[model samples]
Target: MSSPLSVILTQNKLTGENFNDWKRNLLIVLNFEKHSFVLAQPRPPTPAIDAPDRDFVALERWDNSNLSAMCYIRASMSNVLQKQHEEHQT
Candidate 1:
């Protein structure tokens, strides 16, 4: 099948106003989960800007934590997901 996976890819652009409301908070949680499972594992490492230091490693670790949280949050929405597999011609 050559069909592209039609996943409900939500681009959550959370703002300070969203955080102030409870309903938006739930959406934040829901969106995080959908993003993590549907999408592939995100890259954690960043390019060296000035020099390689512990700060960079710490930043990377923080990003990894965010990624992990995203995956966990997305666990609830796995049922309605649409997965597509590309079929190649031999």
Candidate 2:
């Protein structure tokens, strides 16, 4: 079973509405925890005509040196995603 903190850490979706706050908070939390991570917002291949209509893709990358930490984080994220999928299906 994964811990609640791990699930909360990985479950946030970075959207334009809260981009600045999300980035700041994520950096602070990950840094304080000594977890190396990269938060990137990639641009779509085809740009949207309207600025607000543009889709932003957020990618998170982290080091896998610590096996336990890696597994814990991955499992937590997987569990949350699975729950989200099931919820959408119902």
Question: What TM-scores do the predictions have?
Answer: 0.31, 0.31
lDDT of 1 by residue, 1-90 (tens): 011221221332223344344235434453454433223345445767885687587666656555544443343222332121112110
> Which tens-of-lDDT digit does each residue in 1-90 have in candidate 2?
244444345565444465565456455445555543332322234535553432322211232213333343344343545455444311
- Candidate 1's C-alpha runs over 4 A off are 1-48, 78-90
Worst lDDT run of 10 residues, candidate 1, spans 81-90
Clashes by residue pair, model 1: 33-74
Q: Go through the candidates in order and give the C-alpha RMSD of each one to the true structure.
A: 13.1, 12.6
Q: Lowest lDDT 10-mer window, candidate 2? A: 56-65
What is the Å distance of residue 80 in model 2 from its true position?
Answer: 14
Q: Using TM-score, give the best candidate's number.
A: 1
**Each prediction's Cα lDDT score?**
0.39, 0.41
